[model samples]
Target: MALPASSFPTLLFFLFLISHPRCEAAESFSHYCSYNRPTTPAISKSIAKVLSALVSKNPPKRLNTVSFGGGKSKVFGLAQCHRDINATECKSCIEDATAQLPHLCPGQADAGAWFDHCFVAYDHERVPEQHGTGF
Candidate 1:
């Protein structure tokens, strides 16, 4: 069966809509949790603070790092979104990443989660200052 020429444009538009990637919720890509180091209550509190800071603070740039607590309880965290995304999108992505980390890496003192638009990581020790250098 042959379709009318008028329908071709409509069909093409529908195809394009499905093929194009839409800016929806952030999607998880990968995650890591260090099993060697178990988290103490102090470390856990620090982790919570770090994650909260990562989600609550809005950065001028795409990347942000946060440190909380002191001594053995200290925790360092980093959150970053893709440069192309807008502030709102970045926030959403970071929020999503932060929200998932605890569940994905429960009981671990060091953990990281990678999302489609952003990345979140936290550790009892300081992470690298540079991005893409690994945690």
Candidate 2:
């Protein structure tokens, strides 16, 4: 059976719509956030202060781990940027990440957020030092 010319164009258009790929920008990259016990008001304040400092003044090397407060109220924090990224871009990414961390994790004592180009983490206890791998 032969189709009419108008019908052929309509069919072709539908086929093209389905066969062609859709172009779009990729969603921003992020990592999982682990939630632990809630912190006391003092500890929470310390965490916020340290994280704010990290965002405001990123280290020269782009990797920084610091501790704030003392005793039970102490908080540990770390921030890092991809080595390939420039200082300005790294700072921007860290700033964005720090801004989002509290919202994403709420009151959790231990939380971490990772972006495509940067990462941030905070906890009540210090991050353990890694030993040499035997395997």
Candidate 3:
């Protein structure tokens, strides 16, 4: 038997939904890693510290900046989630971004990743201000 005309639109809508999946918060969009490699073990340690801090902090407003160590060994990091997403999603996205950065940009002095719901970056120097610039 043939389906009624009333069900055609509903069926098409479902098909479209299935064909075009929504972007997940943890889905990676793009990434960048600086050409400058870490010159000392201290900087590498700092990078790990800052990245760990970023994941542990879990900003309530969905944006955070973290720093570790001092002087030449200093490492700075920034994590920001899209305002549309909730805090839990923001946290999860940040976690994923942090986990991927080390593998995505190994030994680099600065690296960044952009995901569907958030952005994460770290550098030996201070990370650039991400506020009020429309990212």
Candidate 4:
């Protein structure tokens, strides 16, 4: 006979579970962060929007806001990807990274992701654009 029918369902189920697909837990996205901290909803929303329309992240280009909460909290952020990436690709990466940032950091003000062709960052401090590596 062809193996007991009783075990077939269990075996198939196990196989399905193994190959179905897996997503890293909310905690596992830490590898994509650096020098980040908790942020306000406004900041988070703003960053996410900028990231969504980026044509490139390379050259360490960034957009930030300062003097929040009446006069404290300065948002400093910089996102950089590979200089080789086209504007379209860079934009996509920034959008993707931004969408994931809030979820990855969860209320965090500062966060950054260095992808093969892009990088992103957001924070509440002075993000110096030293070296003139901006485009």
lDDT of each: 0.83, 0.73, 0.82, 0.52
| Per-residue lDDT over 1-135 for candidate 2, one digit per residue giving the tens place of the 0 to 100 score | 899888998999999988886843222354444555787899889889978978876857677877889998888888877778888778877788787887777887777766767777787877512111110
Better of 1 and 3 by TM-score: 1
For candidate 3, what is the lDDT? 0.82
Cα shift from native, residue 92, model 2 (Å): 0.3
TM-score of 3: 0.74
Which portions of model 3 show Cα errors greater than 4 Å? Answer: 1-25, 129-135
Candidate with better lDDT, 3 vs 4: 3
Tens-digit lDDT track of model 1 for 1-135: 999999999999999999886856566778888899899999999999999999888556687888999999999998887777788878888888888899898999999878877888898977724336332
Q: Candidate order by lDDT, highest to lowest?
A: 1, 3, 2, 4
For each candidate, give its TM-score against the true structure.
0.75, 0.69, 0.74, 0.50
Writing each residue's lDDT as its tens digit, candidate 4 over 10-81 gives 999999989876642122223344434556666655555544434333324543222222223445555554
Ranking by TM-score: 1, 3, 2, 4
For model 3 the local lDDT of residue 93 reads: 87
Tell me the spans in candidate 4 whose CA falls farther than 4 Å from its real position: 1-37, 40-70, 128-135
Which candidate would rank higher by lDDT, 1 or 4? 1
